[model samples]
Each structure stands twice: as structure tokens, then as C-alpha cells.
Target: MDIAFFTDRRNDLGESPVWDARRGWLWWVDIRLNRILAADALGVVQREWTYSQPVGSIGLAMGGKVLVAAFADHFALIADDGHAQPIVAPDIGEGAIRFNDGKADRQGRFLSGTMQHGGQAEALAGVWRLERGGSATRLETGMKLANSICFSPCGHWLYLSDTLEGVIRRYAYDPETGALGPREAFFDCNTIGAAPDGATVDSEGRLWAALVTRQQIGCISPEGELLRTIDLPVPFPACPAFGGADMATLYVTTIADSGHKLKSDHPDAGRMLAITGLGARGIAEAIYHT
Candidate 1:
């Protein structure tokens, strides 16, 4: 697939790339930049907001406000007016971990993951769930790098990717109770420099995972079969999303210099990517506000 160059001003660490269907725009964050940005379909910067703290992820909440995974302090409620309020702070004693890539499930619960900083072991990270006007609950614990948190089209299955162990585990989810069942190996990525980061589910229930170091996104079937692969223009593709009015456009985000820290050539490393003709089923996009 051919990708249209959006911008060459790469981000130091671009992540959690999502499409806000209600606003018809793409929203993403530069973790190192401490900034949240929105852009039009044509890759035009429509709006931007800088945060005093590092924002790991952003998703639509029950109200008009947005839910943010504040890296250091805790989860924040970001109003449309650009105001931020801490909803839940990390309880370090009870395994206080920094929030990472997260999204909203169909049942209106915020599904986010956490990573322990300061040289903590990989097993300390976890995936948490937050309901409206409720407390945060840990869904899965002992995760290496709890990233790539997403739900299937039917909302019956939840996918979590651990970049460190390069494993994508699936859990049977009860949407009504927001409960997760036994964990099973969904997909095992054991290739060198091909760890799974962020993921998205297509309308067909197919999983598309971003392999950061290998510079390609893996398209796997629900039965855990490798269907095909899409080559990316640059290495370190952070996340992927299907957007456009029909949800046919495949949008991807990459990390330019975070790991290898590319020095020369290909300045579009950290910028987002748009690819057409993917010919895959795309799930419906969600918004935080009703």
C-alpha cells in the first residue's frame, strides 16, 4: 500500500494514535513532547494542546470530557475546554504504575495499561479498567509492557500486547460486568526486533499489530493465523487505526528516534502514516462524548 506523507516533523515519541470519528480528525500524543495533537484527514494540524505531564493515551469518556492516562501522576479528565483534572492517582504502594496506551470499550469502560518506571521488573505493569464515576480496577497484572490495549468488534474479546515478551494475549470479556476471564496465548511474536506494541481490530475481527523494530504491521486472523504483512515507510510503527468516513483508511503511528534514535535520513520516522487499499474490514470508531 502507498502511504501519503503527512509531515516530516517527526515526534520524539509518538504513540496512542487514534481517530476521533465524531470530530472527523486524528488525535495523537508525543510522549516526550508532552503534547496532544489533532489533525485533519489531509494531515493538517487542526488543534493542539500541551500538557504539563506526559500523556500516555486519550479516549472518549461517558461525558463530553476525555479520559487521559497521565504518565506520572494518574488518570486525568480532560475537558473539551482544555482543562485537566486528576481522576485517579497512581497508588505506588499498591503497585502504582504509570499509565500507557489505552482506549474505551463498547461498554463505556476505559481500558488502559500501566508500566512501572525506575527499573522495575516487567511483571509489575498491568492493565486496568475504569468506569464512569467509579474506581480503577486491575484486570491483568504481572505484565512486561502493557501496551496495545484494544477490544474486538463484538466486544467479547479483549486484546493486550506486551512489547517486552512480544506476546498478544486474549481474554474472554463479559461486557456487561466488564470482567475478564482466563488468559490464553493469542499470538506469540518471537522474532528478533519484532515486538508487538499497539493493536487494532478490523470489522472482520482480524488483529493488526504494530511491530516496532521490524518496521511492519502484522495482520493476523482471529484464529491466530498470520494472513499478510504491510511494509511501513519507516521503522518503529507505534500504533494503527482504521479511519475515514467508511473506516477504510489504515492510519499508523511510528517512533522515529526513540529506540534506535535515527540520526540521518527519513525525518518522517515519528510522524503518522496513512495507507489506502488495505481491503480489510474496519470496526466502528467510538467517541468519548455522547
Candidate 2:
């Protein structure tokens, strides 16, 4: 598929591509830069917001606000005016841990995962669920790089990836009670020599995952079969989201290579990419309940 540039500016670690249907804009974050950006469908800059600490990911919430997983240490609700209110603050003791990738579940509960900063090997990282009334619960633990958090279209399964291990796992999910059963190995990327970074489910229930090291996105059948791959110009595609007027466009966020070398080698390494004519549509993103 042909990829088009959606942004000129580059991000050090651009992750978390989300579509704000209510505002008709695409939103994403530059994790290292601690900035959140919103742009129009035509790749025009609409607005930019920055926070005091690294903003890992964002989930659309009611009242024109966004639920933010900030600095991997806390969760907050941020408004368009840049005002924020603390929701849940988990004490991740002094270590190299911080939030990385996340999204809302089918039932509007916000879920985020943590990663060891600088790729350090630490067992403190894990996945968390932010309950409706500002409560936090640890869902999974003993992870190094938690990523690729997405739910099945039927809302019956939850998928997560441990990038460091190069494997993605699936869990039986309860949309109503936010309960997750034991995880089972879904796909192993080791054979492909790549790690799964981020993912999203399409309207047809196919899982599209960003293979960061392989420079492509893999579309897997709901039954865990390899379906197809979408090649990208850059080497590090951090995350993918389905957006656009008809939700047929696939938006991807990439990160700059080590020492920003890809900025010269690829040029489009950190810029957002929009892929169209994919012959598939995306399910609407679930809004976070306050």
C-alpha cells in the first residue's frame, strides 16, 4: 500500500496514534518530547499541547477531555485548554519505569502498560487498568516492555505484547466487569526477527501490529494466522490507528532511529504516515469513562 506523509515535524519517540471522532482530528504523542499533537484529516496542524513530564498515551474521554497516562507514574484527565486533573497516581518506586502504550477497552475503561526506561532490564513494569472512579489496578506484571495493547472487535479478547520477548498474548476479556483471564500465547515474532510494538483491531476483527524492527505492519487473522503485511518507508513504526472520515485510513506513528540517524537515511522516520485504500475499515475507538 502507498503511504503518504501526514506530518512534517519528527518525534523522538512518537507513539499512541488515536482518532478523536468527536473533534474530527487525529491525536498522537511524542513521548520523549512530552508533547501531544492534533492534526486535521488533510495533515494540517490543528493544535499542540505539552505536559511537564513525558506523556505516554492518550484516550478520548467524555466532556471534550482526554485520559492521559503521564510519565508512567500517574493518570490524569486533560482538557483542550491544557488543564489537567489527577485521576490515579501509582507509586512506581525509584526505577527506570514509565508508561508506554495504552488505549481504552470496549467498555470505556482506560488501560496502559509500563516499560523500563532506556531499555533497562527491570521486572517492575506491568499493565494497569484505570477504573471509572479514579482507582488503579495492576492487571499483569513482570514485563520489560509492555506494548501492543488492543482488544478484539467482539470485545471478547484482550491482546498485549511484551516487545522485549517478541511475543503477543491474548486473554479472555469480560467487557462488563473488566476482568481478564490467563494469557495464552497468540503470535511469536521471533521467527520474523521483529518485535511487536503497537496494534489495533479492524472492523473485520483482524489484528494489525507494528513490527518495529522489521519496518512493516502485520495483519493477523483473529485465529492468529498471518494474513498480510504493509511495508513502511521507515524502520521503526511505533503504533497504528484507523482514522479518517470513513475510518478507512490507517495512521501510523514512527520513531527516530538511534541518534536520529534515520532522520537522514529515511527522512520520514518520525513523521506520521497515512495509508489509504486498504479495503478495510476500523472500529470506533472506545471513550474513557471518567
lDDT of 2 at 227: 92
**TM accuracy, model 2:** 0.95
Error of 1 at 271 (Å): 1.3
User: lDDT for model 1, on a 0 to 1 scale?
Assistant: 0.76
lDDT of 2 by residue, 237-281 (tens): 999999988999999999885233334356666888889988889
Clashing pairs in 1: 60-288, 61-288, 203-281
Please give the range of 10 consecutive residues that has the lowest summed lDDT in model 1: 256-265
Q: Model 1 — TM-score against the truth?
A: 0.91
Best model number under TM-score = 2
Best by lDDT: 2
- Going through the candidates in order, what is the number of backbone clashes in each? 3, 1
